[model samples]
Target: MAQYRWSYTSLQGKRYIVGLFHGPKTGHLMIYVNSKIVQIDFKVFEEKVYSFFLEEDLCEITIKKDNGSYGYDFQINKEVDTPLNRKRKAFNKVNRNRIITMFVGLGVFLAVIITFGISQKRKKEREKERYLQEMLAKKTVSATATIDSVKWSGDQASFYFKFYEGDIQRARIELIDKAAVDLYTQGLPVLKGDEFMMTYYTYNDSTSLKLNEPTNLQLANFMYRAFEQEQKSQSHLSEEELRCRVKCAFRVSGISGLADVYFQAETRESNPWHNRLTYNKLVRDIPFQEAFNEYCLPQ
Candidate 1:
């Protein structure tokens, strides 16, 4: 039940907000200019076009029902006014166009920087590999390592593994390839606790996976289930009630990617916040209530 809102500015810099409202309950179509209703009509169908003049420019507002939310089309002086144009003229007026142009230029500049950075990173990786080859002369160690955790920083991934070797400060070795990624995961998206015998080379304080490439990495099945859970939990309700929530975020600890969980309780609507009560099962099974409303809903 939202009215389609738009605004226009004349050549003399006079601006006015134009709103087209088609009430579903009242079945009335109304056009408002500067918050004042200029035209009203009764209609059973949802499609209509209202035309008016703003200064010397002819304006047209079209309300056509679509599968999604209704499409509201606005035009002035025979040319359709897109949302981008409306935003540029209505809200920003003077500085938005400049800011937008500068942003586009800045984006191009950042793209160049990112390309340069990737080239440098790959070059450094190659140099390190070459140095290892020169000193170690293709020597490799085969050891069984239990996957501790896996983490990703952009396209590069680091795998933390545990072995009986005395040096146990969780040194990171990035050898990203599809075969290695498939070898460690426990059929879950973020694979851990799996054991595999891998050949590696050590240089100074860093380790590298020999020549194998990691590829064909697919995300876990839980993503679809999580999205379904979110949608199912979004059913609307009329009244408000008490809700309690528990939330957690993944935190890096030593080498384990364990969760840092938080708990809170709030009194809000059933659609946005759960109306059912929740308890802090860890701390003596106490019910968390409205007093703890600084909550996080998992959405």
Candidate 2:
């Protein structure tokens, strides 16, 4: 039997059925424009097929025989230029904005890099100047004694105090090393005007003899010994002995390298944090009477 294939376009934005026809005796079947076959019901003596036409972006239909073999053919016009033009316009706007933003960001990044480089250069120059000054100072002082004493002006370590033999009014030079200072000051509560003292025995031009206690441990041991001695003494003590013999705990702190001794003593009295004292140049902590005789005036 002769058959005819039909094709058309849908005006509405939907699929509209076109036509249905008989199968061909030879070659593949071709369906067009939104056309499809609901059923062909092919038997042993029959050959029937189905097909469809599709827009470029739309759905399509297929055709099959009773043996489960299938084929597809699409009828399409040329791709439209309108949608392509719209997409190109959108892409151009986005690319222009992206290029402008990239240029601005690049400028800011370059400015930051320049600023950091300049700051780093200035810092390096300043450090070099400081180093040169320190070197010059060291050279000038290299010929003089390592330890120089201006006067007993401000606070200083007690260990550095100078004392002379036989002379009570004035003294020559006393070099109490750090270890001795720590030992003598141990267990003695911090008192007012506690200070560090250092003496420079200028033997020759470039050398000076310096000696003192070695460590804080030595000082602590000395204090414990003093406390024990005081306890053993049978002297009839007055109010002064009462203060010295009172049980106390100490909190200690100091600067690194420099021998600065700061101590706070908590007495068994009304206030726990009653007495506090600091000594920059700590030599030793003697009884008030002893200290007055040794360092201050005639007894």
Candidate 3:
């Protein structure tokens, strides 16, 4: 019998252990964190030397049997020194130097700098929290809308609907990505006359609304395609052009509000960085009427 062991710290700062034991005809492998086994696998012995791959950790392990009993040679291969690793190392070095400097003659200056940095960070965090709270505190309006039209182009779609809130009757448009459209239609074709209940929050100074329902699948297949398309074209286009391209697709059918809702939800969750700043700013202040005139209305 032979035994081998390897250990490494994960990117998330968690320690893990990988152990392998080889007998006459079979080999057993175990992976653990803090002495709690997380994975176990078995392989049939083929030769004196055996190699296998671990998918979870992206590592390869080779074990060789030695002449002496209870002896084995272990070799573990892992990708280290990546860009993230290098950045972490650099950050650690800088932090270490800063700590050392603070302990020396410049302690008062370092203390003042650290205090100012922390104060600024806390102020920004408080501002963000206040913004979210204000948004959530707004009044919610509920109404039912009948889909009057459905338009599709490329990976985007628009739904035109009419609704009545109290005595006020209005026609509204909602935009959705191809993934949301797929979900709304249940893989079937979308048509006019579909209906849904909409609950949205309205801003005080503007007629802009934030939707509160139909949380679309975050990792839909069409979303992946959209990401791929953005990645391919992002390098060639300016920030403004990319923003206009995304906004224009949903704007033509006057469903820009729906697009805003979708993007806002995605930003709150996990949105890609390509044109993110531009898209976020575009939808930040504009109401539905302004967006419709700028992008949807024919000049």
Q: What is the lDDT of candidate 2?
A: 0.38
Give one digit per residue, the lDDT tens place, for model 2 in 43-149.
32333333323433332333444563333333332233444445555788799899889989998998999999999999999999999777655543211112223
- The residue-by-residue lDDT of candidate 3 on 176-283, one tens digit each, is 787765444333333355445675455542122222222233123223333344435455865454444445434532233223323433443354422345345554
lDDT of 2 at 278: 26
User: What C-alpha lDDT does candidate 3 achieve relative to the native structure?
Assistant: 0.52
What's the candidate order when arranged by decreasing lDDT? 3, 1, 2
Candidate with maximal lDDT: 3
> Where does the lowest 10-residue lDDT sum fall in candidate 3?
205-214
Badly placed stretches (over 4 Å) of model 2 are 1-108, 111-115, 118-126, 129-133, 136-222, 225-299
CA displacement after TM-score superposition, residue 277 of candidate 2 (Å): 19
lDDT of 1 by residue, 1-299 (tens): 55788878986899999887776666677888996888888853677777877876778887778764467788874445755456556667568788888999999999999999999999999999999777776455554555677777665567777554345434444547554543443122444654445554544444544322222221112222222332345335211211122211111110111110111132335212121232123212322332223343323
Error of 2 at 29 (Å): 60
Local distance difference test, each candidate: 0.51, 0.38, 0.52
TM-score for each predicted model, relative to the true structure: 0.26, 0.25, 0.29
